[model samples]
Target: AVPEAADVDFSDVAGGAWLMDHIPWTEASHRIGALNATAEIARVLRIAMGEAVLSVERHTWRLNEGVTQVWQYFPADLYHLSARFTPNQGPHDQQAETHQQARPTDSQGG
Candidate 1:
């Protein structure tokens, strides 16, 4: 289930940055903890991709442009996670093109 918008907090950007910087990347537990922490951050920000608000996609938390006062969420944490999690890497352009093709067209031609 998606987390509620109110339940998500995006105020820990600095803390998350510190954790990402200090954690020993070689430790498996640390990596997992970082992932969990990222998830927690997502929970707080109420990120949602495509249609569902608050649903995390490919380990990314999507946020509205202006909802959170913060300009960026967990910049360091997300960078570290991206380097550590191969699957979390974003889809290539080809895959994105295919997905776009499959999406139902909107009446307004969106």
Candidate 2:
């Protein structure tokens, strides 16, 4: 990717952006993309139900109310639930069968 732009001389290029003369400007865009992926991984680890929120305020500029809003992964609730639960519908069928067994008998002694 870097090499493609390296071949194009600034004078040969159509645009007149000041930073276009420097290669680091192109590199900076790539750097930002890499950081975004890392940030997403960090985000997933810290999320819980009803915890994430975005508060944007408009003043002199569209400022981020809390730029450092980050989360840590809490697997305790999910881990325990997964460990105790089986991935089958057999339990539901068994529960219905139990209800049938517990029905009141009319012939029982009063």
Candidate 3:
């Protein structure tokens, strides 16, 4: 069964085909009932895709026009998340060596 739409937990998102399954939902109208259904569907997507991005299919049968449409991309790569980390290296503590330490030549060292 689907969970509520209040609190969205992305970690529990399972990788699968959410759109293919819940697109033809009969209650996708502008009414309150339809709004609730849309919210539920979004919550599910957040869990399954592990991403809270909006994805609307513009080239579909009914849904068209360049509007907001939430869809799944993939598991979030910690490195790709610019919000938490920079592209320099790993976490804040683990940093990449900017330059190799100067080494002595064969004849320079005994």
Candidate 4:
């Protein structure tokens, strides 16, 4: 259950928008990879094996409380992802920030 959403009414705006507006921003983690469709992915996305896909999983949290988890899949040939980072200038414990780019994958690969 979403403990953070205990008393929230999501009748006006979209649920996602409400979550973004109401929940405090904390941190998110992402995992991305190119893979063949798994059974679950095939059922949801109607994809087949040998059909390469780009999978992205993200989990977000507010301090120690888990907020949301999401997974997105795209045909590998139709998209590309790239990220660039500048060295962290903040405290040693903080992570470096990343700038991301998304475009069509080339014939060779992403």
Top-scoring candidate (lDDT): 4
Q: lDDT for model 3, please.
A: 0.33
Expressed as tens digits, the lDDT of each residue in 40-84 for candidate 1 is: 555654433222222222221223222122223332222322222
lDDT of 2 at 83: 20
Candidate 4 displacement at residue 77 in angstroms = 1.0
Candidate achieving higher lDDT, 2 or 4 = 4
Q: What lDDT score belongs to each candidate, Candidate 1 first?
A: 0.32, 0.31, 0.33, 0.71
State the lDDT at 92 in candidate 3: 51
Clashing pairs in 4: none
Q: In candidate 3, what are the lDDT values of residues 1-110, reduced to their tens digit? A: 23332254445753223433543332232111111224455465333323433332222332432222333222122112213346676555553322223333477462
lDDT of 2 at 46: 51
Clashes of 4: 0
In model 1, what lDDT does residue 51 have?
20
TM-score of each: 0.17, 0.13, 0.16, 0.60
Q: If the candidates were sorted by their lDDT against the true structure, best first, what order would they fall in? A: 4, 3, 1, 2
Clash pairs for candidate 1: 8-44, 9-44
Query: Pairing residues by index, what is the TM-score of model 3?
Result: 0.16
| Cα lDDT, model 3, residue 97 | 29
Could you tell me which 10 consecutive residues in candidate 4 have the lowest summed lDDT? 92-101
* Candidate 2, residue 94: how far the Cα is off, in Å: 56
